[model samples]
Target: MQEPTLLILTALADEPRHGYGLIQEIEAISAGRYRMRTGTLYGALDRLLSQQLIAVEREEVVDGRARRFYTLTGQGRAALAAEAERLRSVAAEAERRLHVLRPGLQGGAA
Candidate 1:
């Protein structure tokens, strides 16, 4: 839906990740722009799972505490690809506009 939400879906697109792992991945992927709280993370997870975009792939205990891993569904993959494409398109347009306006926005590329 939004950037953080889209980022969450993108992170989960690569592989199954537990809640905490998903948070870490998103933070890393976005270079720390998206820091997800447990409440917000779980809320998004529930919505995605309910929409059949993601599924609980497995549950296990590492040190006596249970954790669940979630994997993206086919629908999730398509959505992620579409979202990525959209973001890329936006970035490309931004770069084109910057080229017209500043003419050195790329920092030594031109």
Candidate 2:
């Protein structure tokens, strides 16, 4: 999965969120490195919804406006778990290779 998709799934894994809430959470998750635009976020959300990876958990009325909250489906959780494991495995392999290449490297750093 793409980083944005992975980040979205990871964010929703904790709790359902509305669009603005999702944007805020994702920014926090990326440590402000990622600032998602409204159109991009909605596009990703639409794709995920159509793929059945995420579902509308609920809708709320905030200031007389409806806000949809999205949550990860069972399949989404499984996919996220798999992706996280894959990332960990790749990182470990990269570290191993780095150590082999640089004998004096300490814990994956020169």
Candidate 3:
């Protein structure tokens, strides 16, 4: 899965969020490394909705504006779990290789 998609799923894993909330959550999750544009976020949300990975948990009108909150589906939870495991495995292997290459090195940076 793409990084943005992964982040979105992760953000929704804990609780439902509206589009703007998702944008903030994603930015915080990435430690400010990624700033998602509104258009991009909505597009991804639509795609995930179609894929059945996410669903609209609720909709409300606040200050005359409609807000749709999204939550992760069972499939989305499973997918995110799998992706996290895969990433962990890859990182572990990279760490092991790094150790072999530099016996005294404990991590990636010097």
Encode model 3's per-residue lDDT on 51-93: one tens digit a residue.
9999999999978989999999999999999999999999999
Candidate 3: give its CA RMSD in angstroms.
3.4
What TM-score does candidate 2 reach? 0.87
TM-scores for every predicted model: 0.84, 0.87, 0.87
- Candidate 1's C-alpha runs over 4 A off are 101-110
Q: Spell out the clash pairs found in candidate 2.
A: none
Write out the backbone clash pairs for model 3.
none
How does candidate 3 fare on TM-score?
A: 0.87
Give the per-residue lDDT of model 1 (tens digit) for 3-101.
767877888877899999999998999898778899999999998889998999999997887899999899988888888898899999999976685
Q: Which candidate is the best by lDDT?
A: 3
- For 67-97, candidate 2 gives per-residue lDDT tens digits of 9999999999999999999999999999998
- Judging by TM-score against the true structure, name the best candidate: 3
Error of 2 at 98 (Å): 2.5
Shift in Å, residue 61, candidate 1: 1.2
